[model samples]
Target: MSARLAPVDMTAFSPGRCARLIVKVGSALLVDPDGQVRRDWLKGLVADIAGRVRAGQQVAVVSSGAIALGARRLKLPKGGRASLEDAQAAAATGQIALSGVWAELLHGEGLTAAQILVTLDDLEDRRRYLNVSATLDRLLKLGVLPVINENDSVATEEIRFGDNDRLAARVASAAGADGVILLSDVDGLYDRNPTTHPDAVMIPVVEKLDARIESMADRGSASGMGSGGMVSKIEAARIATSAGAHLAIATGRIDHPLQALATTGHGTIFVASQGARARKAWLRGGLTAKGTIHIDAGAVEALRQGRSLLSAGATRVEGRFARGDLVVIAGPDGTQLARGLAEYDHVDAHRITGRRSEDLGTILGYAPRSALVHRSHMALL
Candidate 1:
C-alpha cells in the first residue's frame, strides 16, 4: 500500500480570522546583498498590510535590518565579523534611515507607521511590560501601524533579544495578537535541511513542538544577512503558540508575502495550544502573589462556580499590595484557592473587608470596581 497522507485545513491559515496580527520581516527580506533596502518588496508588503488594515484587522511589523543598513551607510568592512560597538554605531545610523523608508512607504499606502524600539527588559519587567502593552494598544486603537524593532543601538549581548523572531513573539503576546507570521528566505520548516538533503519534506502543520521536531531544526540562518535560523524560528513558534497565537513561517522572496501565505497556504502553520482566554489564564497562573486574601467558605464555593470574589466574602487581607498586583485568594482555613489582579490597594482592601458592595463607597470614600477580584482576571487553582 502507498503511504497515507494527512488532511490539510486551508481555512486555518486565513489571516482574516485574526483580529490582531504580527508580521516579522527578517533582515534578508528588507535588505539586499549590497546593503540597500529592497523597495519593491517593501512596497508589496505595505500593500498587503494596507489590505489587512482595510479588512479591519490590526497589524504590527517587527523588522530587522538596522545593522546591515547602518554598516553599508558607514562604509564599514563587509564580510568580516564586526565588534559590538561597531554594530551598535551602525544600528544608530541605520535605524533613522530604516524608519524614514517605512514612514514614506506606509504613508503612500495612506497608513501612519509609528516606530517602536524596545529591548528585552521592556518586556521582562512587569511595570515596563504593562506600559509597552498600553502604548501598542493605544497606537492600534488610533489606527496606526506599529513598526517594532529591537533597540540594538543600546542593547548589549547580555540584554539583547538577539533576533527579531523572539521579539516578534513577545510583541504578539503583549499585543494580544491572534497570529504571528515570520517571513523568511525559505518556504517553511522541513523534516531535514532541505538545502543539504534532496529528499527532505516540508511540514504543513505543527500541532505541537515535540523533542523529535526540535531535533530536526537546523542551526544557522539560510540568509547570511539575518541572525535567526530555523532553531530560533522554532523557539519563536513555541513562545507564540504557548501564548495562544498561531505562528506561520513562510517565504518573503515573493511579492505580497502576507497575502500569499494567507490565500495560498504557502507556509508551515503552528496551531495555538489554547485560545485568548486560556492565554490570560496562563498569565494569571504565572504571576507571583504579592499578598493573600482570606475568603469565607461561601466565597470559595462561589469562585469554584465561576463567580467573582466580592468584598462581602473577603474576610481578611494580608500583605501590602497595590492595585493591579497579583494576589492569592485563600479559603478561611488558609488553603490557596485562586490568584488574580487586585482591584483595591491593601489599605482600601483592609477597610472594605467583609463589607457589602453597596457599602464600598461609604467605607473607602470612593468606589472603583464592584468585585474585589473580577472573574475575568482571576484563575482558579
Candidate 2:
C-alpha cells in the first residue's frame, strides 16, 4: 500500500511552543571504553531536561547504548562480528545499569525518572498503545520524566524495533510530541559521507522526502557500538513526520544536545504532515487485521462517506474473531475500507446476518445500541 501522507511545516513553528518533545540519545554518546554508563553525561542530560521542566515543558527521553555498555561490563569476548542475539544479551545487561544511572542523576536534580522498556508490539497493538500513551501522559502530569528503551532483553527478532531511532519517532507520535530530536555521534545528515568527501554539505531543511532524497541516503557506519545509522534516522523522520510530529537529527556529542536543538535548531529538521489522534495513530501503526468483513455496495459507500457499519450491511464475516478483536472491513469488490474492533463474536455475527441494527436485539435476544463497529472504534484503511 502507498504510505499515508500529511502536511506540516517546521519553519512555521518556533522552538519554545513545542511542549511535548521526544529526545533520542544514541549508545555512542552514553558509553565509555570500559563499558560503563557515563555518569557525567547522564548527569548533564538530566540537568538539561530539568531546565526544560522548570520552563514547563514535557519531555520523553528515548535512549540507546545499553547493549554496548552491557557488553563492556560483561567483558564478552570481542568477536569480529556480534550476532543479534549477542546484542540482545548485552542490552539486557546494560538496560538495568542504564536505568540506575538515570534514576540517580534525576534524583540529584530533584526529579523522578521512570524506565519504560518497550518492543515494536507496544506501538503496533491498539490496546497496548493506548495503555502506554495513557501511562506516559499520567506520568508527565505527575511530574515524572519517562526514559524509554527497547525491551531488548525479552523481545525476539520478529517483535523488535531493531533501533531506538525509529522507536523515538513512534514514541513522539504516540505522545503527539512537538519535536523529536535524534541525538547521534555525527553532527547531522550530510549529502554524502563527509569522512570520504570533505566537501559534503549538511542539508539543513528537509521540506519533503521522496525517491530523490532517499537515493542520497546510506546505511550507517559499520561500527558495532551504535545501532542506528543515517538512513535509520531518516526513516524515523518519515515516521514521525507522517504522524504529525516535527523531527530533527542532530549531534549528540555536543553538550545539552536536546536544549540546543530546541533553541538553536542545530540539526537536520524534517517537516511533519498532519497530526492524528492517539487512536488513529495506533490504528495506522499497530493494529493488525485478523480477517475481512465483506460488505454490500451500500455499506462500502457508507464507509467511504465516513459512515459506521451497521448489522444489515455486513454481508459476511470472513474470519473467526472474538468480540473486541480487530478486523478489516471490505467492499464487495474486495478492497479494504476500514479496520475496527468487532462488536460481536463471529458466531453472533452469523446469527444476526443481514439484519439491521434495530433487528439485532430481536434476532439475538438483546437490543443493539450503535453501529456494529462504532466509528470511534474504526479507522479508515
Candidate 3:
C-alpha cells in the first residue's frame, strides 16, 4: 500500500474562459431609478471592454434600458409594466439616447459600435436568423462592436422576448460566441436569498440546469430586477450552454463590473455543454455517420478547443454524405473525435478539401460557407 496523500479541495470557485463573449447589461446598471445614465459606472464597463478587445476577445452587448428611460420621461405608473401603447412610445423616445450613449462610450475606447434592434420573431424565423447571424459575423470581422436590444417600439406581445438575458443567449448562439456574461443586481445563484438567510450559500458553478437547480430562483416579482429574475437566467443558461457557450451571472452593481468577473468570489458559471443539449445529445448517440473526414493534427486541436472544422484543415475525405447529413470528424490516424452536420455534400466536400475558406466559393462556384461543420451543428464525443 502507498502512503496516503493530502486531500485537495474541489469546491472553490475559479473563473475560466471567454474568447468571443456576449455581455448583457441590465437596466439597473445603466439607468438609475431616476432614468439617468450612470456615466461613471458605464465608463468603467467600457474600459473593461477595451481591455477585452486588447486581449483579442470579441464582444457583443445586449442592453435593456429603453423602456425604463421611456417610462420615466412619460411619467408612467408608480409600480408596474406600462401598457403596450405606452411602452411603444417610451421605447421610440428613449432608444435614441440609449444608442447614443453606447456609441459615445465605445468610441472613447477607440472601438466602433453598431446598434441592432430585434424582436423574438426575428430569431425564430430561419431566414431572419441567418440574416442576423451574417450581419453580426460581418460586424465582428470588420472590428466593430455590436449593441443589440429588443425593438420594443413596434413588437407586440407575440414577438416580444420578455428579458434581455434570453435575447443575449439567442444572439450569442447566432454570433457563434463561446461565452455569455449576465451582469445583474445579485452576485450569483444562491440556495436562498442571501439577504434573508445568513447561511445561504452561493453556487459558484452550475454543471446542469436540472429542475432542482432551477427551483432556486427567487420566484418573486420581476424575479429580482426590472424584468429579469433567476427564472429567466436559468432559461438563458439552458440556451447558451446548450450551444456550447460558457455563461456567467455576475453582479453589475460594482464599478468596473466586467473586470470584476475573475477577482470577485461572487458569481455562478454554467459550464459549456460537451454534447449535452438535446440536438447535440442526439448527434452524439443516435446518428449513423455516412462519411468520414480525415483532418490534420491542427484541425484535431481546433476541434478539441471547441471550434468548427475548416475544410482547409482536412487531409482527406472518405465515403459519401450530403449536406446536413451526419459525418464523422476523424484524426489523420483514424481516431474519431466528433460527428456533425455537413455544410457541403460529399462531392463538394471532397473537391474543397485542403482549400482555404476564402477560396471555397472560387472552387465550388458559389458563396462559401466559413466552415465544413458549424460548431452548433457538431457534437464532440
Candidate 4:
C-alpha cells in the first residue's frame, strides 16, 4: 500500500494554530524598572499560556529577567553593563527566585513548570542537541510546560554577552516547534525606530528574509533593556524559520501580550516555507524501521484523529529497537498505519505495552516522558 502525505497544516506557519509553540519573553517585560519581578503581568500571561494548553497546543516558555531580579536582590548596578563574573553571580542568585516565581505562577493555572537551562554550546553539540530534543518532546507530551533559560551561571556568552532571542529560536528548532513568539518591548519589526520616530511604519509580516529585511535592524531598531536588540531577533528569525518554525516579534510590554498578538495580530510574523518533516531526508533514506508497535483498534482510531499512540492502546511490541530509534506502527489487523521515533526501547516497551500512562512511573520506577509515540513525531501512512 502507498502512503499519502497530509499537511502538518500549521508547519507552513501560523503561530495561532501551531501544534507546538515557544513563547519568548524578555527581561524588560518580566522585570520592573526597579529590578522586581512583574507578578501581575505574569499572572495574565500565565492565564494566556493556560488557555493555549487547554486548547491542546503544547506551549513552552523561554523567559528572561533572572539577572535583573538577582541584581536587585544583591544590590548590583542597574546600568546593564555588569562584568561576566558579576553577571554569572547574579544569574546564580536569581535563578532560584526565578524558578520559584515561575512555579508559583504556572501552578495557579494548574500547569506544572519544568525548568530547563542550557547554553548555546549545548545546542551546537550534536549529542547534546538530540538529548535536548528528546527531553523537550517528552515534556510537551506529558502536559508539563517547560520554562527554558540560558545557563548564565556558568556560561561565558549567554546573558553576560548575548540575548534570549537567539536562544529561544534554538530551543524552538530543537523542539521541532511550529511557531515562536518573541515578546519584546516593540510591537514588531519597523521600517525605522518606533520609539524615536513616530512616523515610523511597522512591518506586519515578513514572508522572506532579505538584505532589505536585514537593513531594518541597522536603522536603530534595538529598543529594550535586553541585549539582543533587533539584530539578534532578526538572527533568531533566520534560525527559527530555517528550521521550519515561524517566529514573531511582538510587544510584551502590555498585559496579556500573547492574547493581544493572537486576537489583534499586532506583530511582525516571519513565516516558514516548510515543515520540520519537509526535509524527510531520513524517511526518504528508506532505512527499515527497527521495530513495530501493534496497536489496538482504539489507538488506531486515536491516531487517525491526530492523537498520540499511547501504551494503553498498544497490544504488542516487536523487533529490537532502542529508544529514539525509528519504529513502525501497525494496527490490530497487522497493517502498517504509521512510523515514528520511539519513546522507549524494545525491552522496556515490551514490559509495559498495555500499561496506562499514569501507572508508568510505578512500573518503570521513574517518571515517563511520553506515551508510546507522540503525535508530533509520528507520520501516518
Most lDDT-accurate candidate: 1
- Model 2: colliding residue pairs: 6-273, 7-273, 27-65, 124-286, 361-366
lDDT of each: 0.85, 0.75, 0.81, 0.80
Measured by TM-score, the strongest candidate is 1
Model 3 C-alpha lDDT per residue in residues 138-256, reported as the tens digit of each score: 89878899999999899998889988989999998888787888988777788776767777777777888898898788855332226788888889999988877778888887898
TM-scores for candidates 1 onward, in order: 0.81, 0.71, 0.74, 0.72
lDDT per residue for candidate 2 within 213-293, as digits (tens), equals 676676864355776788888899899888777777777676776666666666677877654443355564476777667
Winner on TM-score (1 vs 3)? 1
* lDDT tens digits, residue span 1-381, model 4: 001111122333455688999999888888887778889999999999999999999999998888877877788774233787777888898888998999999999999999999987788764466579888988999999999998888888532327889999889878989889999876677787656776777777788999999888842324345676888899999888887788888778788987877766767888875666542334434768999999999999999998988889999999998876789999988999988878788988988889998988888888785778777567788
Arranged by TM-score with the best first, the candidates are 1, 3, 4, 2
Which residue pairs show collisions in model 3? none
Between prediction 1 and prediction 2, the one with superior TM-score is 1
Ranking 1 against 2 by lDDT, winner: 1
Winner on lDDT (1 vs 4): 1
Looking at model 2, report the run of 10 residues with the lowest lDDT sum.
Answer: 1-10
